[model samples]
Target: MTSQARRKKVAWGITGAGHYLTESFDLFVQFKDTFGVEVSITTFVSRAAEEVARVYGLFHYLQTISPGDYMEEVILESAQGWSYPKTGRFSRGNYDALFISPTTSNTVAKIAYGIADSLITNAVAHAIKGGIPVFLVPVDIEGRIESPVPYFINRDICVGCERCQEACPHDAINEQIDYLKCTGCGLCKDICDYNAIQGGQVMLVVRDIDKQNVKRLRKMERITVLDDPSQLERALRNVLTEEAG
Candidate 1:
């Protein structure tokens, strides 16, 4: 491994929203494989992100994907005797940028309103204060987006089996699913051997405040709002290519 001086550092914060979680994970692998030698990337997961990943059966996968680091609202101050010292990388100029992909409306609103209560929020706050670049992909920017998720279950095929319930880390299902808690990770669908979980879609309604926050996000010089997951790859590729050039 090269020394810190030689590699560009990047911090990636994953939120609770599952709109593009799988797609974002694929992109992470692509980024690492393509730029492993040139960049040092650290991943931070929110508490909600951990729950959603478990629901998607990605709990183990997340750990194996990278050298892992996570932050929750409860554990604010760490050994550094400061809350969110990880963002210190930005202030110290150790990191080139921060990327928050698939940012939930909650996260986007908090960042736009200067709410730095959560780990991810605090990191973004510190990063922007430090003049570091922040690239974010908001899930609710389109106002109404078609999210392909497991929206239904074929009860006849379920057979009263509790495997799907057991597989759900968020306790979002019993005989029926609890929509409020479900992050649409599809882990229940993945674990059901009887094919009871049918594939479906849901139309997410974006809030007016979220739209306003997007507007606020647009005005920030340090923040770049990516239209979607694919655009993130192109954006990073372009920047890295320019740096190389």
Candidate 2:
């Protein structure tokens, strides 16, 4: 049997779409239990994802379970404040596969257009450039999906400290909140000591191009597209089996 230290590694990137965020973590837990010491799993998350996970009440699951699996921190900024060296793990052969789950529409658009502004986007871009295989699970693949929307529960409790605004990665919070830019990560609710924030659900309407772009992504070389969250375990099994062969 191969030693745990010598096990192949997988880089899992989480984005800020609440549609399947909870399902994604459940899939990861199963992947870890099945793979055992055969694979090392590290998770990288976007700023928006951090917020969304907190909003959806799944961040605690990630935080508590990740350390045991060698999961890395939730990366909010670029590695060097400009470029993402975390992708170096893939470039240097440290990571055998790249998996991005519950991919936000914003991330899909960025990847489709070859944009790499955020950590998740940059990691995917670099992995593709390096000829590494990428597994993507886009939330808005076909039609409308339910997503979370977070807001202040009581204006009276808000102290005008701007902590929630600062915590928001998408700049979605201002004197007036911008729902379109919000990822609904719900970090603000945790940050607000006064208990002034709350999370709600809304249906996110996907545009024609949103669906078309994801379809186009499926045609890309070395990119395995997954529409169902349950397929994640199957996909990881395939990757590990291929490597073992």
Candidate 3:
């Protein structure tokens, strides 16, 4: 095999994964074949995450690697340190970066605050030890840091079911909700019918994919806020593209 064609990978680790399962799934399909570098995505679903994935058709799009076949093969079958999904071997010798897209505000604060309750958070901490690059897409409407687009909005009437309270992954919702702390992805507001929920977008931060290099990635931002298989391809391609010139 030609050295250029030989595969070198940048492993991606996705968590809070339920929220963006469909997004993640589509991302793999769009780039996996074109890039030739394996686009492995791990869905770290607990019982709750699984339910969301099923309801939202996330599992359907992620069938191959979602631990069940109801979903499709666009998603790869991978696992975390504990049984989860991964793109390639992430051991000491396998990866170039660690990225978590759609990073929940809970996840962002936890990592920034030193909380490692789940697989993704734990991995982020681990990445630092090896000088690994870590990118993040923390979804929080908290304080209007800045936004690429307005958040999802609800135009219907209000039922006040408080059903949204049950769906919150971070217990951030309450009768008197704090918009600042909210990522505004609208998971809760979307499920409601009375239009009780409001608008705002989750923050998008690319934790590990270096921004200077992101230009080479074809359509990276749309898939998952944090991960982009094309980003890895660009990095790899640049190696020879630079050499060729």
**Please, what are the lDDT tens digits per residue for candidate 3 over residues 8-90?**
33444444443444455565445444543333333334333334444343444444443332211222223234443332233
Per-model TM-score on C-alpha atoms? 0.77, 0.73, 0.46
- Best model number under lDDT: 2
RMSD of each: 5.0, 6.1, 10.0
lDDT of 2 by residue, 1-245 (tens): 44543576778899987788878989887777777567767788787777777655576666533565334444545234667776666666566788999898888888888888888888887788777789999988876778755564567767788888888887878865666565556677778887777656888788898898898788877788898687877888876766432
Worst 10 residues of 1 by lDDT: 71-80
**TM-score for candidate 2:** 0.73
Inter-residue clash pairs, candidate 1: none
Model 3 / residue 181 / CA error / Å: 28
| Candidate no. 1 TM-score | 0.77
Worst 10 residues of 3 by lDDT: 68-77
